[model samples]
Target: MVQKRISEAKEGKAEEPNLLQKILSMTVQERKDFWDKQFMKCIKCYGCIDVCPVKREEPEELSLSKWIEKAKVPPPYPAFHLLRAYQVWDTCILCGECEETCPAGIPLKTLQDITQFFSPEDVFELVPGLDKEIKDVILRFVDSKRTQFRRVTYGL
Candidate 1:
């Protein structure tokens, strides 16, 4: 599925979209409605963030995992998951820890997968917890704000 998504992304197809691409094209209301179902199960325990091995253990409140608030009993819709998706998308190695740690049985791995579908093929090797150096470089490049960003590599 990942390979197919990458292939379709590279091709820039506009015809009938697959399930992964469908998520990207969903309207604001449609997206909110869709995620509402999934997030309703979340208890805001932050277990998904805690179990994420790809994230840096930073004490700073704005750091990746710390961006999620501790006070919200129920997480704020899909925002938590969306933020987490960007945090780990390029580096996730398909580990199921986040989903496993979720007491609510939310499919966190699947959510991450959907987000990673658009990650740059060069940056996202799906290599597991062993690519910290490469992940850091990618994050640094993004934070530097060198260009209009989208993971898809066009003629830029």
Candidate 2:
């Protein structure tokens, strides 16, 4: 099935739009509505959280997980989702396991892809002096101009 679609796309015979193009075409309000609907459907199963490999873990002094707050279902708008998104921004491998494990069918992969598309150089940029070593590495990367910014940092 997938090979046929790829062949048709190569031959310019595929009629359906790609997911990224479809997402990019949506108006801000439409995108918000779409995400809101999906988020509202979440049952707070924590499956995505469990499957995510990038979730931040504080040092031994602090709690095991400090990034994701323990909130109620429907998670007070985008807080839960955004926290998870940002926590995984730098390290997400796009493994699709989160989506696969989600019982609510929240389309975690699609949401994560959109987040990744917009992710900045450092996910903790706003937090001052968090990881100086990594920051120095990134600065070197940027100054060297060895590759495009996204390619160097994100492997895009």
Candidate 3:
């Protein structure tokens, strides 16, 4: 079945709705509301994290895992989900087990599908205000570099 899907994808015969396309079609406010609703449904079960097969294995000194406070209900908005989402981006195999185990039926598979639409840098956009801040920082960096290049090339 997996091979058949791959062959169908290569032949452009796959009829499934593209997850990235669905997400991109939404307005910014819609995207925010979508994620907010999806994440708020989490019951702090940690099933998603538990089912992750390639969780970060870094030793203590090099560990960068954002520790989730399991005791809190709803797990403080996106923090809990964000950490898990980022961790699974490169590792998720699309097995759907996490979604199956989630008692609240939070679509772990669909949430993880955001990786297809976003790179790590743009992932911050899922949180309000962070997207604008990231854009500003990138613009400032680009402008500063352009100014430096002009000064060097044209002796401005």
Candidate 4:
């Protein structure tokens, strides 16, 4: 069933609209409505963030509550939340720790895995072996951003 869902998602044939696009397209009301439903299970235990290996790389100010708060404030651009969502692709190891720890029983790992499919860099990371061509591609992708930003931003 998981494989089937993944295959359908890859084919853009999932019954629900693409979550990445939907998140990118959300209005204020829509964003709030959507997150409220998803977060209803959240107990504010901070288990997800706590277990996330990449939390150290995330901005100190970015928190689940902050994301929910952002959802309530505006439309057209969910810049902070969207950026944070994208960052999940860079940090997640598909470890499933967050899912297991979630007191609310949210499928956090599944959400993260599905979200990764929408990130080209994350897709590249899933390639089977490291070869010269793959190395070149990864370096080029990394180098492009190095030139684009001044500070040291290691993760995507």
Candidate 5:
């Protein structure tokens, strides 16, 4: 499989990598720097969450604010955007609203894509009943932040 992919890349038949693949392929420091640059541009408007269809109130037992308090614009390492993505990891609908609503142009939807869409199969091994394929859809991410995804074969 590895050799096939290498040969295909050399032959120009390899599929173009998506945002999730491209971002995940980055080195640790590169990923951190990418996120830092993206988050640093945030004005802390919370517009991403405001426009999210999956936005839900944080549960007390699983609260995240204690560990990551609200701060000024260009907030700390784990900004609200990151925390919000963590909170919705299991329930994200991937409608692409958050990315569209972000004023700073952060690619927040890619986080959702990376976590649930293209993630490794064992990621949900501990959750006996969780079927990751059930979340898969005909979604694609372009170079721009206009990636749109709708649940293709399931009723919401």
Candidate 6:
């Protein structure tokens, strides 16, 4: 199943890379080691965050990985980094500015692309479950911020 999906993606038949193949291509240990090395090179310069279009709109109070770490333990429902990662699917222009600006040379563009493949639903599915409370909370937050923005402005 995974191999077929990867082949399909490579052939452009699939919209994105197979999530399972992306995960299986690297072992858990490999991922840990890769991230460990990348994290070591991070200077916390916020360049990546600044370049991230999603972060521009959302403006995370913390760095990307820090947000992920925090979301993993307590909240678990609305993982900001996970949402940001998937947002790359539509928002990423592939201009590669984030990768170029990274002091760590962590291949931010590739990572974002692959992660987006795995979780495209996160972009459209603001509320994964039918939990009305969670849905209402997200709707209120998003609508409040977006409702005032002009659909057309400055004759773009």
- The TM-score values for the models, in the order shown, are 0.53, 0.59, 0.59, 0.42, 0.62, 0.45
> Lowest summed-lDDT stretch of 10 residues in model 3?
147-156
Clashes of each: 0, 0, 0, 0, 0, 0
Off by over 4 Å in 5: 1-12, 61-65, 117-156
Q: How far in Å is the alpha carbon of 78 misplaced in model 3?
A: 1.5
Evaluate model 1: give its lDDT: 0.57
TM-score of 5: 0.62
lDDT of 1 by residue, 1-156 (tens): 544665576578545665445655555556556666768788887788887888764423225344446777566545566556655654677798998999988767766665455443321332122134435544554454335463432211
**Highest TM-score: which candidate?**
5
As a whole number from 0 to 100, the lDDT of residue 57 in candidate 1 is 48
Give the winner by lDDT: 1 or 3.
1
Model 6, position 112: C-alpha lDDT score? 62
lDDT order of candidates, top first: 1, 2, 3, 5, 4, 6
Cα displacement (angstroms), candidate 5, residue 111, comes to 1.0
For every candidate in turn, the CA RMSD to the true structure comes to: 9.8, 9.0, 11.0, 11.8, 10.6, 9.3
How displaced is residue 156 in candidate 4, in Å? 20
Worst 10 residues of 2 by lDDT: 122-131
Off by over 4 Å in 6: 1-24, 52-55, 59-90, 120-156
Candidate 2 ranges beyond 4 A from true positions: 1-15, 58-71, 119-156
Residue pairs of candidate 5 with colliding backbone atoms: none
**Which candidate order results from sorting by TM-score in descending order?**
5, 2, 3, 1, 6, 4
Query: What's the lDDT for all of these models?
Result: 0.57, 0.56, 0.56, 0.49, 0.54, 0.47
6-42, model 6: which lDDT tens digit per residue? Answer: 6777677886663334544455566555544554465
**Candidate 4 residue pairs in clash (backbone atoms < 3 Å):** none
CA lDDT, candidate 3, residue 109: 75
Residue lDDT tens for model 2, 14-82: 877565444555556666676678788887777897877766662222221443346667664354555
Could you give candidate 3's per-residue lDDT for residues 9-42 as a string of tens digits? 5567887635444455456787778778877787
